[model samples]
Target chain A: MSDLNNGRYGIHGGQYVPETLMNEIHHLEECYEFYKNDKEFNDELESLLKEYAGRPSLLYYAEKMTKDLGGAKIYIKREDLNHTGSHKINNVLGQVLMAKKMGKTRVIAETGAGQHGVATATAAALLGLECEIFMGREDTERQKLNVYRMELLGAKVHAVTSGTQTLKDAVNETMREWVSRVHDTHYVLGSVMGPHPFPMIVRDFQSVISKEAREQILEKEGRLPLAVVACVGGGSNAMGMFYNFINDKEVKLIGCEAGGKGVDTFETAATMATGKLGIFHGMKSYFCQDDDGQIAPVYSISAGLDYPGVGPEHAYLRDSGRAEYVPITDDEAVEAFEYIAKTEGIICAIESAHAVAHVMKTAKNYSKDDIIIICLSGRGDKDVSAIAKYRGVDINE
Target chain B: MSRIKNAFENKKAFIGFLTAGDPSIEKTEEFIYKLIEGGADLIEIGIPFSDPIAEGPVIQSANIRSLSGGTRISHLFELVENVRKNTEIPLVFLTYINTVFKYGTEEFFKKCNESGIDGIIIPDLPFEEKAEIKESAEKYDVDIISLIAPTSEDRIKLIAKESQGFVYVVSSMGVTGMRSEIKTDLESIVESVRKYTDNPIAIGFGINSPEQAEKYSKLADGVIVGSAIVKIIEEHKEDSGKYLKEYAEKMKSAMKN
Candidate 1:
């Protein structure tokens, strides 16, 4: 119903793509509208999520962390346990299935940390669809293991060498690829960003995180958590974690942005912290740009969160006072990465460590009886080498 | 008549494109003269963007080279003003929407009007979202050009009917680049567009050769050649004027045939 309003979240989102991709995007919107209500489509997606991707990921109570923080009762939503090692599979499987239904034989995607690429490759392999992923050349160097993983899953990976050679350039290359091959190839955009239907579609698929978390928390604690926190890259995981809780006026939806060094520095990806309203990547949203409106080359230690803009929905949420976005510095996130691994023995993704870092800094502010839910969006296997190098412990992968 | 309308007067227009400051702003000025000398009816001066999604490698590289050379929107505005003093040839800007929106839409178009820019082609701003910038463009008497791609099957008439200045018919379903052959049925797309608006229709994308321009000019009122010219600039750098003039003359003469 919210999306029925032209896919806009208070004038933030719209279809701003080229004319070449307009009709294809329209067809995608139509297919999504029709299939969202069809029982067969829903049934197939449910089966795929449960059987192949492993649905209903654990909502483990972090007793050690809760006791150590000495304030809120902490619960970690273990999306990291999901197949493909991140929440990306939830949306990928849904979109890939929809692509199949729409008679698409191939799926293409852009990736940052390579989690989304790996997840998309896995789903495409399962459904027998050809898959190709575009990743920044810089990202390929940093996240080489993910490149190998995607190749092993039978997806060809292109090292994009454009602009800053990061997530933003990867997205540009993917859109270019999509425009050229829209007839048989579907762009399985791996974020709650981009033009209409994409922000809406990705959100619907990923909302499963909150749909299940809300139920599990109610069954266990019998009360809503005071705050739900998740890391914001293109803000898919955060949007999913906050979607079901949006109506609960008492619940605080908090998003942690990647502050590469600090929000005050040029080397940062804290869009909400220092961004202005601008349009790029097809959606009218807050973007980190120069005075001339050129998108800045944003930097973040976590490749996934090194984007210049946030999702349009997240922009609306930030503007409407329904949610709050805070920038977590690389130092803080790395510290939390080490802290969580030592405290709970859970080696979470560095992207997720941003959320944990926020929780670590604020959990003590809440009462002992109060509750907090942290959405661990992915596992840390891919980031171990990077984190080790960051901490002066270089271990080759 | 408006400069854009005059461009199509009794002739098949040859529209040439180049990034505003690919190597430097002065060089772009020299290149514009070369295009005019070789017989360009209209020129599209591209305002370099940080991320040009609609462009392929050729234009994308030009954008990077322009930006790295410290070209800004204000500099391009000044470029237009300087170029306007010598030539009455219609000049337009081809850029992403964010550049205009960030520069303040009203202020951007006002500057365009002052600098003598006849029109603008925003690849990212579709018909449905044109209102965001159309008012400002109209206020300044600048035509907000509409692009109808091969994929714009049902929406071609809608776009063409409301199209200002000229209708840009994207010859294929891809980013800007040179292709050996264009397989899309452009005559039919042009036919459908012809049924809606009387404005000139110029076909672009993958049109590099004079033969290709000659063939496509038969179906539409104008032929737009971008990447090919930008590629020439990319190859020759500052010494590109002679080659650009020769290429433009060849393509323009071929279209005349």
Candidate 2:
């Protein structure tokens, strides 16, 4: 059984949702346990990951970046090469397949930057199940191209106008929907957050990133990297990138957070850096909240990382001192986003740029013999317009 | 027996819910006494949080209005203390877990005891996660009420078995909103809960009119009207107390019959 089933990472995770949704979560936990070790389930999931979503994504050496930083030899785990463009496809594929195995006819998900929603829609289309996605109204405007992509994939996109109309509100809207349709529908939660089974399930599916990267890095560099890094939002990619290297005590695991303008300003989503322990979205974790404990409205240029809360497991890791989290400003992320495109000819998602920004600043601290593998979580085609807007250019023109 | 248990002994109880400090604080204080005087057997006060995920647009808007009107947790507690001076009826807090956790769970419940509150209903804290808070609630003598919705199939028995104060049975499958019709086979649900424990059940969510209360009360020991009462506070503003008195009286009479 998964260690997370009891939903505690030393007092960080638990099912803190409404009683109306309790039975569904319990049933989900039971299903996850039964199928996790089941041979048939694993076999089918493995086949899908390999044939459909393109597993074993490359770990490419960033020679130009290494030279630019003038210190360590850097490597980028190209999760962007996955079929749906982001590491989110890894978890979506696993969840949609699980929904099929559980006899669910429909699947629902919430998205911020539209990456998770698109991945879910793609998986649902392949599995021949009905798909519905909830995106914040603000997100639909910011990431309009992704809205079109989801609709083209045959998923209905609901523009959630509630609350701040961002990822947090989208999560709230999806949870409400799931409660109403729990009988025949499954909520394909995008991140390693929310209630129990989800954090465990997403982490397990995404852990394959570090699993493959560890092997690839060993083959190429003859040893584990000095450090591994990824961006943290609801923290799927970071959790995935850090999971395998956790026990390798010498290997540092760092998570970069979107520090919109600055942590000193209210316009930030750096949960671990500036948040307090509070219960929201079914988990007791670090949440950006006001004095009264009400969830504070968070912000980031990268919509995907603009959530008020981090995954429960991330909270556990941070508290245990197993992993370190740092803030990456929007200016730093945008600079990295442009630099990688210019040097490596790769347009990376603004979300992934947060990690790249972290690497760009700290890579020079290590010697040339050191290896630093960063999780490049997604392609940036969906973010082209947003990037253009940030640069004061009209990409449409 | 607790006041909540005693409430169900005489006849079918009428439970009214309101988001404290909605419209204005003074009017909310007036509505509290009017709610009890209008025959509210038990009261559920809502501490408005920025994100109330379980609520529909009606209560959601009400929450927004209350929060924007500067309804702080401290203000709500003060109002609760004021209300305690007037009525000894069972009062429960219907709030999200974040608010209580923010206030410090043990501290929140301790204040509940000091201020004469009987129970609390956290819509986001399910049965499996209750142990942590339940310990604090027990130490403070505050009943952590259990809620069983229509979606709770086999788990109804489990929830009812461990429920304190009374069971809150959701009338429909959706969030808190008034519905013209409630099609769930609630009698069977009540029967399932009964197989576990003899806890008195109060049906809520989607109940608004006297007719709906009359219908649902037949299946349970009490009827909880939330969105309807909040809708009154939403529409009437400062004058909600007069309308709520008439509405609460009418609904309570229907539950009794």
**For every candidate, C-alpha RMSD to the true structure in Å:** 1.0, 1.5
Worst 10 residues of 1 chain B by lDDT: B171-180
Write candidate 1's Cα lDDT for A1-397 as tens digits.
Answer: 2443887999799999998898899999999999999999999999989988789999999999999998999999999999999999999999999999999999999999999999999999999999999999999999999999999999999999989999999999999999998999999999999999899999999999999999999999999999999999899999999999999989999999999999999999999999999999999999999999999999999999999999999999988889999999999999999999999999999999999999999999999889999999999999999998997997884
Steric collisions counted per model: 0, 2
Q: Lowest lDDT 10-mer window, candidate 1 chain A?
A: A1-10
Best by DockQ: 1
In Å, residue A162's CA in model 2 sits off its true spot by: 0.3
Model 1: per-residue Cα lDDT over B1-257, one tens digit each: 99999889999999999999989999999999999999999999999999999999999999999999999888998899999999999998998999999989999999999999999999999999999998899999999999998889999988999999999999887799999999999999999999999999999999999999999988899999999999999999999999999999999999988
Off by over 4 Å in 1: A1-4
